[model samples]
Target: MANPEQRPIGDVSVPLNTGDVRGFKKEMGRLLEDPLGGAERLDQFLGLNIYTWVELPSILGILFTMEERDMIRHSGMRVWDRDSQGPDQGDQKWPMQDPGWNNQNERHRQNMSDLQWMIIRGIREAVPKGQNLGKAVSEHQGKDEALEDWLE
Candidate 1:
């Protein structure tokens, strides 16, 4: 994998665009809205490319809201530290760690660790099987990389 800092979040072996933050966020929302529907398109977008590098800071930006930015920062730190003992250890990684916030013409990614964790915690608490989806998404979508990705 590319150096963590230089790793373009867009190349995580998943389909995405390495571009600006805003459009990438919007596209991510759309993809998450219907991953299956977006899967084909995303796959095509990525083409034959493999081994995508993540952009930690940008990932946090798109995934988090202003109110939760600090929390995301903390989560990112935990990710970098390889501490499975992260604050919200059991929460999902994708949409937080390896978020697919990309567009066709973008060249970057963001980490929304805090907001995603909150959503994961909230959803799980609110619904009996909600937690399952979070884990499932991360695993199926290939966001489950080593914690070291965040550290570099």
Candidate 2:
């Protein structure tokens, strides 16, 4: 059996309903407006000693909620806005007019990868040069896909 602690990226796609998406979007908007507070909350979530803040560019604003953050803490999945390609278009979801979405599974995968990278990048920016922050972020990124294999 595959070790429960180790999961592949393909296995970590989360099944988010419309409501989950909406709530996440709302919180992201609020967080964008207040980077410091968001950083504090994220630091809490990440259990990091450093107080790092990010000024979410107006073009980039999608983020997973604290609740969902906990839900997928080690699940290797995340919520993201795939339509705008940046984060401006939360209104366009899967099976909508967005190009190439085509199906629900595809949509979930898009957001999962996008959000995961966003989280990784956010941490990379916050960590100082000598702290081996990349290694730190990779630890979480390297966690075995504890979530169910969604590739099937």
Candidate 3:
């Protein structure tokens, strides 16, 4: 038999429901806004973090919310204006709308990959010995699949 550690976790897909999408988006946005606070961070709380298949939908959902909220302006990313791409139109920007992060390029998505063991090691180095470190690591392991899948 394969060792438990060698076994693959079941696949998790991002749900298509709007509310779920919205909730996930909000949660991720909250995380990105501050990668160092809240119960969520109680899990694997440090790293450049990559997205996994499971996390794709929610991340995209959050990106959509940011777009709608204008929290991320396309102009800042140097994307062409929507109207500018076509004939004379209103003040809309980025004709061919796309995902953005903290008003940055989709490249921010790459941050996920950088968030690996190095980050965990960094956290271990920063925190003291008796400050719920074990609990933090345990919780983060539980969420690893979810987080990793989202990055894909």
Best by TM-score: 1
Which of the numbered candidates is closest to the native, going by highest lDDT?
1
In candidate 2, stretches whose alpha carbon ends up further than 4 angstroms from where it belongs are 1-12, 29-32, 39-117, 120-152
The CA lDDT of each predicted structure is: 0.41, 0.37, 0.35
Model 2 agreement with the true structure over 1-152: per-residue lDDT tens digits? 99977964343323334454345455543433444455454444333221112222111224645543333322222233422346433323211232432223555445433443444434333322344434445554325665454222
TM-score of each: 0.24, 0.23, 0.21
The clash number for model 3 is 21
Off by over 4 Å in 1: 1-19, 30-63, 83-152
TM-score of 1: 0.24
Per-residue lDDT over 9-105 for candidate 3, one digit per residue giving the tens place of the 0 to 100 score: 5423233455654554455444223433422342333223344423433433443444332322222122222212444222222123332432122
lDDT of 2 at 55: 22
Supply the TM-score for candidate 2: 0.23
Better of 1 and 2 by lDDT: 1
Q: Please write out the lDDT profile of model 1 over residues 46-108, one tens digit for every residue.
A: 334432225434443564455455543344344544544454343343333554644332433
Q: What is the TM-score (0 to 1) of candidate 3?
A: 0.21
Candidate 1 yields a Cα-based lDDT of 0.41
Q: What is the lDDT ranking, best to worst?
A: 1, 2, 3
- Residue 18 lDDT, candidate 2, scale 0-100: 46
Q: Report the lDDT of model 2 for residue 57.
A: 19
